[model samples]
Target chain A: MGALPELSVDIGGLKIKNPVIAASGTFGYGDELAPFYDPSLLGAIIVKGLSLRPMPGNPPPRIVETPCGLLNAIGLANIGIEAFVGEKLPSLATIKAPIITNIYGHTIEDYAEMARRIEGVKGIAAVEVNISCPNVEQGGMAFGRDPDSAARVADRVVENTTKPVIVKLTPNVTDIGLIAKAVEAAGAQSISVTNTFLGMAVDVATRRPKLANMVGGLSGPAIKPMALYLVHEVVKAVRIPVIGLGGIMDYHDALEFLLVGARAIQVGTANLVNPKAAIEIVNGLTDFCLREKIKDINEIIGALETKGEDHEKKGDRKDKSKANF
Target chain B: MDKSRYPMVEEVVSIGFNREIGKDTFLMGFPCVALTSRAKPGQFLMIQVDRQAKDPLLRRPFSIHGVLDSNRLMILYKVVGKGTALLSALREGDTISAIGPLGNGFTLPGPGERALLVAGGMGIAPLFFLTQVLTRAQNHSVKMFLGFPTSQDVVLIDQLKGLGVDLSLTTEDGSLGIKGLVTDLWDQTLSQESTQKPVTYACGPASMLKEIAQKAIARNLRCYVCLEGYMGCGLGICQGCAAKAAGSKDKPYYYVCQDGPVFSAEMIDWEVM
Candidate 1:
């Protein structure tokens, strides 16, 4: 009868109703999915990737289904940052949850321009820097792949935007912990680890690629294990909160991230499969807390039990991540 | 005006029937109230083949074929790939975890307007549902042009024949009614029939729709089309089904799953799409 459980959390100082955010690219500005359920019911919503100018995106067959996952080479298709701030921000204002806009660019300047433009925007609680889209031909994963380049992009956005900045990291890099440390040192308020892995699929009979572009970012449950390791390493390497995402399907997956030290979790590919997934995760997490007699969801954060025999294994892993840092 | 349409509804509905209507093509019926009651023509449903499968993680999107009652409807699908093949294994009385009535439906004809429905291959699903909406209207002058590769490739004839429409069927191999492409039949209709320049509504291969859009543009006729694309989410989130805007220099793309499964003929940019 009473309030079930406290599920809200703050990321880089932005308060959310819960710890489940609809990840960028999966929740298209929240306007389309708003019909199915009030997106405000979730912790927050991150709109799709936007740039300085509107992108026409890649050609047809942008997405192809892989075993337990999807490969997409959409090339960061979006209404430019100006159109989004001008046309889309107003509608999202009426919603109760914080709106985190996902911004991408072909260059560091592009990221800073978008950041500067949205600096004083009323509704957007934070700006998520997407420097890790592997599908695009240029500028997306380029910056995130190198520590120096990632630091430059993060520093530019951090300096330009008064609103908090969450750098969205890609898993395609060799050592994500390096990029996390670089961004954190550059003053990024928080980190969203990780983005999709670069992969491709083809129809062997026709001798044609499944997607129009030869390669794309792979997402879904297939990449979760790899993503969990990356998140855990990044959480261990950096002091900033890690917003975990990359095939989080349900509350159990969300719980996994929180336990691994993610301040919150973003529902990405799962939103494509189920529009209400973020809300379901929020509701399910409350149910889990109720059943377990846990009153505070914060207790679940970094709750991974690494006792006795497991200490050596996790400690060795930490040492490796430290080397990357 | 129609029953209030919902963009997304999830339910495990019992398949009242599942059978082959044509070669490698089948129809499955589901009696789910949440969908059928609010269903509109041109809307689609995403059938999750194996909820446990990850490779083909996305649901196979199927257009609503027809509304049988307040709680029953059917999905017409062709077994082309992995998802549909997984769907084909289901039998009558089996339960399907599906979500629908997604996307913007076909805009119904006005009081004074006559309807022209063009379909190609399995794209006939949404148009077939439009015929049902037209059948119940006062202005019932519905002309249909259905195109298939050959006679053996055709389906939905017996059911469509019952609609009392001015039906025209075409096959590329001359194995059926008029010979040549479906566009040939459309050209013939334009030149032959003189029914106050009927408003055109088409759902089919991109080529056929483009042909109609071009012809509609030349003749100055109102046209609407439903486009099919490889989609991740039948909902608009993935942007996987983005259609290149045709004939426009300003805006370049339209989200096919949301902005339209149905679009005005001239509004799309065909050159790049």
Candidate 2:
């Protein structure tokens, strides 16, 4: 096979070697995935959620496995932004791929503070605002749930740093389109959609909640369809690029995201099963493009739109209809 | 320190699903792991609970308990969280991913002196292998001080005793052993000792380890405390498990995944623990 054609793409100010990047939290700082696989192959690695101060995160047990999905109530445990610059960022400078940091805050100032502090870091490519965090009080869900609040945060960060800001939208909202449009209108260089849906798990024996926090954001294969729908909606709503993510495990799913108008794709829960999920998806996409006689793989981007809304709905129904449980 | 050996899972048996541990903790009972790499007293194994299972993404870590030979290693762990919980639900014949004999185990045989091993809760797991190595090393005399919450909480005691080292016990309710915390017994033994340093090794709750570190300092005896930290990557990359070492105060901190899940008493930040 003629060494899968170089699948490079640039989104916002970031230059990705390929269109595949490991979603935040799943690829903890770049080094965790370094030992198992090479980091150079990835488009970029989004580090776990970072805060202004060190957070202990939710009390244990923090994770649960649902069929084809996972529920994590880690509560954004991180070493804080200062530590990221002091310890983590310096280390990532050695890797070839661009490094994207995901920032979470309880207030607008926290988001600005993180962006200001991380400005001009040597290896950082951009900042992805994680507006969907439901566990926190001041930040997280408060900002992402509403288009206005989400845009405000995105705008503040845009002014705070020169680095391209990608606003990550929440799928728990009634209309992800409005939120996507709001962030884009606020001058966001790019928008990444569908940060885990609000979910809860129960103990069958005790009739109690499984996660100590009671409710958590759900991700993995189970949330892919929702992710795709949001990605599709957001792509149409915004003219700027969109980074699509949610339960994306394999290349085929990633191809679907590209067809739905995602300029880039983030591999989230799939990294849990395989640390090399993003690299594999890139390789798979390359292979698929080559097999389909596609000269420019970018042609596949937004390919699903050609089917029209009705055709896409029918396709989704047929796929879900065959799904066993 | 270096991953001289990559991890490979030898077996996976799901004893059952445990709701109390978590909604997902599979009580994956692995009969054996490949121990050829030689994990000392405090080393650990990074276990991928179910190779084929997809929901729980990252590999869960466990402390290595016993190494029978180059071909077989044993880990003693409770079903906690999605990784282990899912692991515990597997059938008799299943394969899981295990990478290990990682981390530097405790230094052994302190100048031909007698040693005492103290464990609290699941902390007792790693010392199982430590005892065997100590007994076999000429000139090193070993004893074990084990504690659990209740009778059913007790495990590996008979196995430890069968190794023919001196043994004592403690329980919170005094069900089957000495009453009170394991530290109580450790304090009693240390307060009275003067000439015999009795190098100590302990594992368990962070609070207990902190107390043990304090007692080790107070008693002027050498001690190694195995630590526990939340991890995203069992390897040192995540920075999720970075911990402050007691003596390294002037310096930054150490990564538990890499620097140590095991650190010398003086080396660990007992206060934070």
- On lDDT, the leading prediction is 1
The digit string of per-residue lDDT tens for model 2 on A133-183 reads: 876556898899888888999998999999989988888889888998899
Q: Give the local distance difference test score of model 2.
A: 0.76
Calculate each model's fnat, 2 decimals: 0.78, 0.19
**lDDT against the true structure, each candidate:** 0.86, 0.76
Across A253-322, the per-residue lDDT of candidate 1 in tens digits comes to 8888999999999999988887777888888898888766678899989989777657788888678635
Off by more than 4 A, model 1: A1-3, A307-325, B1-8, B50-55, B110-114, B176-179
The model with the greatest DockQ is 1
lDDT of 2 by residue, B195-231 (tens): 6788889999988888998889887888888887665
lDDT of 1 at A117: 91
| Candidate 1 interface RMSD after superposing interface residues | 3.6
